[model samples]
Target chain A: MPPFLYIFLGALAVVSALGVIIQRNPIHSLLALIATLMTVAILFIGEDAVVVGFLQIIVYAGAIMVLFLFVIWLLNLQVETGPTGHLALKLFGSLAAALLVTELFFILAPPHLQVKFTHEPVGYGSLASLAGTLFTDYLVAFEVTSVLLLAAVVGSVALARRLPGTDDPRAARKIAS
Target chain B: MIPLTYMMSLSAIIFAIGVAGVIIRRNILVMFMSIELMLNAVNLAFIAIGSRLGSMDGQVIVFFVMTVAAAEAAVGLGIIISIFRNRETVHADDLTLMRW
Candidate 1:
């Protein structure tokens, strides 16, 4: 049963990942991302880390994806041509992604790393333990994340309201609401 | 125990797919999704290692990552909306105002 769960979760992750890449429409891409996030959350669950899994679903699959969907709906964007038209931008993006992949490979490569997954998974730390670690070890990051959210709220509202040269009430209300 | 090599290879393949998407796609939103794919690929590595190491710290960090991803998506989508309003397009080629 456990092996079945593991294989199922892993396959879901890969399929949804492909879905995210293959879909062209932004809304469709967002939907694919939601599926991928959900599958990732499920993977956490299979690992017996229920809290992380739930948070993954709520924060990523729920709140974040809804925000992305709202923006996509608001924009009503038409599908654009492929990046093949712009060789420079495509080249730059490819180079950046390649650099990132290479860096990641170095970081996770087996010889340099000591940690390894074994047959016996560790017991989950209690929620209180998790919270304690988060506060003491990651307090600054926690506070900064809140500030970032606030800034995003303010910035989004502000950006949504701005008019090039004239005041626009519809735009203002759209932003305000 | 599952073979460590198999797990690593799976993650590597997934990561490669994400890199390809970011490079090949022109839509900024789709590009953003590709970024999410990359992040998830990383998360898989974290969890797999966490289980191997007999610790939950990696899982805990995954929790933190999920939070950051949410906040990032909010801000990124916000910016996308404003950009779309200004140009009425999401094409990579059309983002030339800042290009040199």
Candidate 2:
């Protein structure tokens, strides 16, 4: 809620995001991503979205990150070495990013475009209110997401399953032993 | 009260970093992480705007976004694992099986 807290957490999120981009090892990048997710959760809480903030932690930082780590270990990925693009491509990418940032700055800088924080009802971001709206108005969407998640689970399993007589060394070893 | 512009700007900056990551990183996993970063940046903007306007819709949308992100991560990692099984590499550039 405090201005200083926002500034501190925002800066930390930015730095961690940079770490995600710069780290050569995917494992290190995953760690940096965890930091970024945590900071974003804190920022969400600071903005009074308590449910979303905690959900960000439980889902994104906890479950999703563990999944990422599991995949990294499963594949046993090595250090990335370097990107495939040449120097010219890299320069062009940087230039494009810089231009995008500049454009965002100009769009966000107008004095008259600021959003006014009006008086909100008590318990605006409370769990009760969120649940009420979600169940009544967004129920269809909520149910659809559940179905989508189920589909994802099934699809992932199907894709990752090994076929019979595949040439995978690990599979062959399993059959041998 | 913190200015909404500051929060939005911060989100924009992070979004730019995410774009750069996607463009510059060759590892598919890291590129996926960058995409997550971009999603979070949008979530930040959504929450900020919702808070400023005294509405709850933005937070609700964020919940959906997080759900979609979770599903995407699952399916994507599964595909990556499949790719690794067949190709034994994770570099985006090395995935040329579909190319002519």
Candidate 3:
């Protein structure tokens, strides 16, 4: 990938990340997140991790985000009013983020300390190779993830389901009658 | 070719932004999105390091991370919905039922 393209995508990701923070509406924040995820997916592809990149799109950007949007619509959230937190808290948050960015810069700046790219076998990030390694080497983990997803599905349904008389006024009245 | 450090730096910046979002945002949904941002930042760093070392492990880990994140989102949102049903609000500050 070209250096300029990398820079462009990086900037795009950064800006969208900021948007996610700055937007007052959760819907807008989600849109910004979608942009960031897409940019990151492209970056992954640029790094030659094709399968990871596409999965980033199909899973993260596509399915997960749609789920988020669905929840947002279900909740019918209003636009957040005024500022989020106290001024002191906002200042502290910015200070902490700045400090973290500086620390990361110091850690990543030294070229000699960086991991150098080396030759890999052809088809490193291909779906076939990933599948081979996943099924053979990481089979247990793969199966565990499937189980986790199933559990999550069941748990979510259970949690979100309305109980008989918890908050339903009609149910309470019927029981009383 | 783009340098790996650039990718790492971008990841760090985004991660920091995510941290700030989590700290400053009061809405639970936005906070959840910020958490996702932080996770993506880590995934980006992992991919960069893995590519630099000529290994596929990082990408594979990213795959697992994405899966876990998906499950987390589902469960977390379900919890949020449950909370909303009980309280009719999604603001973190308003969720003071356990403060006592």
Candidate 4:
């Protein structure tokens, strides 16, 4: 990846991220976040993590974000109506974020920070190569992830399920009558 | 090739923005989005460092992170919907029924 292109993508990502937080509407924020994620995906691809980049697009931006949009529309949450939050919390939070960024930069800013990515043998970031490592070394973890995903699905369904027998107000009133 | 620090720095900046978003925003959904942003920022750093080291571990770890994030998002949004169903609001400050 060229330096200028990296900068441009970085700037685009940062700006879109800010847009995500700054929007008053959840839909707008969601759009901005998608843009940010897309830029990051581009960056990932530029860095040669092609599979991961596409996964970022398909999984994160595609599936998950679509779910968010669905819920937002389902709930009919148009725009935030109340005061944002305690102003003091906002001020302190911004301050804390600034401090955290400085701290992260300090930690990442070693003298050898300029180390560039040396060329690798063929198939470094390919899917087959990733599977080679995942299936051989992290095989158990991969299987466990499937289990984790199943558990999440079951748990979420349970939580979101509204039992009509008890949760329905009209049903309760009918019983009272 | 771009300097590793540049990529890492961008990661840090985005992560910080995410942190700020979570704290400064009152809307639970937006906060959730900010959390996703934070997670992606970490994924970017992992890929950046992994490539810098010429290893595939970073990419694989990112894959795992994405999976976990997906599950988290599912459960989280479910909780949000449930809460909103009962309380009719998604503002963190407003949902203080459990608060002492």
Candidate 5:
């Protein structure tokens, strides 16, 4: 990628990410997040991570964002009102975040650590190579991920389910009807 | 090819924004989105480093990270929904049930 183009995309991503935080409405934040995810996917693809880039687009921008939208609408959440008095907390958080980014930059941006992008290894972006790495070496971790997903699904269902005669709003509505 | 340092810089900036969002935003849902943003920034860094070194490990790791993020979203949103059901609010400060 051209240096100018990389910078522009990076700037756009940052701006969109800022929108995720700055927007008062969760739906707008969701939209901004989609924009950021798309730009990141493009950046990944440009940087020779073709498979991961497409996965980011499909898994994140496609599936995860839709899930976010579904929950937002299901909850019927309202726009977040301004805090009554949390100026100090906000100031403290901003200061800490600035400090952290500065520290990360100092550690990562040093001239001695600057690694030029090198030649792409054979099959670096191929499915066969990725599957080889994931299945052969990280097979156990992959299995564990399945287990984790199962547990998460079970747990979320248990939490979200409304038992009859409980204080669940849905249950109350059903009773009223 | 862009230097990995710039990628790292971009990741750092985005991650910082995420941190700020999680801390400054009172809405539980927005804080959750901020966490996802931070995870995505880290994924960018991983892919950037892998590309710089001509390795595929970074992509694999990002895949796993995305999986974990999916699970987290499922569970976290479930918790948030349950909390909303009980408390009738999603503001972080208003959640005192867990506070001492």
Candidate 6:
């Protein structure tokens, strides 16, 4: 929990993030993502959020990343070329993001604006408090999120199933032999 | 002893870099990594604010965001697989089926 560890982990997270961005290959990007996830999870653990930290590592670095790798393996993506879009879109996006950050700074700069990080009556970060609110006040939102996840699952399955006649070329060749 | 504000500043810079990466990267997987970077930046902000305020809401939010992120990763990777199945490419530009 030392400040140095916190800063070091944060720096590591940032570096892996850069790798994710700079890596051209999809598999390398996923590897970078996994590294970033591990560092962030360590950051959470260092911050004393034990449950969240564990969940971050388990759910993100473990299950979710495995899913990504599985799909990547299934797809067998070759190093195909991508578009070289005009520079204008990147320029516009950067300008817009900068403006947004500037506006946020201005908005948060007011002298009288006293923001409280935790205003809840019960102590936060505990499983009891989190479950209480998540099941009571925020119950509807939580259930809705589940439904959304279910829908996404269904949609993904639907998307992955091939069109009737589009037998995979490799499969077709195998069948021919 | 670095002040908490410095941590927040570093988080902000990291987030900005993530945003820039997402904007510039054409590969879907790289874009996803950039998003993870942004999320991690937010996580840093959360930890800093939580410690500064001596409160735990920031940590709680981080928990929720992490769960949501996992769900997103599952669905996103699934979608990526589906896209690759149809087009055999993971490039952002190849997602032209919807632009029409």
- TM-scores of all models? 0.78, 0.93, 0.94, 0.94, 0.93, 0.76
Candidate 5 Cα outliers beyond 4 Å, as residue runs: A114-118, A165-167, A170-177
List ranges where model 3 is wrong by over 4 Å: A165-177
Candidate 2 chain B worst ten-residue window by lDDT: B91-100
DockQ, each predicted model: 0.48, 0.72, 0.75, 0.70, 0.71, 0.42
- Write the residue-wise lDDT of candidate 5 on B1-100 in tens digits: 8878899899999999999989888888888999999999999999999988787888899999999998998898889888878777878889776766
What is the TM-score of candidate 4?
A: 0.94
Q: Tell me the fnat of candidate 6.
A: 0.39
User: Candidate 1: where is the Cα deviation over 4 Å?
Assistant: A78-113, A116-126, A162-177, B1-8
Arranged by lDDT, best first: 3, 4, 2, 5, 6, 1
How many angstroms is residue B84 displaced in model 1 relative to the true structure, after the best TM-score fit? Answer: 1.2
Candidate 5 lDDT over residue span A1-177, tens digit each = 899989899999999999998898999999999899999999998888888899999988888888888889878977876652278878987998999998998889667576665677788878888899999889999999999999999999999987676776756777899
lDDT, candidate 4, A34-89, per-residue tens = 99999999999998899999999999999999989988987788888767878998
Question: Model 3, range B18-60, lDDT digits (tens) per residue?
Answer: 9998888889999999999999999999988888888888888
lDDT of 5 at A11: 93
Chain A: TM-score in each model: 0.69, 0.87, 0.89, 0.89, 0.88, 0.72
Q: What level of docking quality does candidate 6 show?
A: acceptable
Shift in Å, residue A19, candidate 2: 0.5
Provide the lDDT at A3 for model 6: 78
Real A-B contacts recovered, model 3: 0.79
Q: Which stretches of candidate 2 lie over 4 Å from their true place?
A: A82-84, A112-116, A164-177
The CA lDDT at A99 in model 4 is: 98
Please write out the lDDT profile of model 1 over residues B1-100, one tens digit for every residue.
4444445545765676688778778778888888887777777666666666666667767766776677677667767877776667777767888866
Candidate 4 residue spans exceeding 4 A from truth: A110-119, A164-177
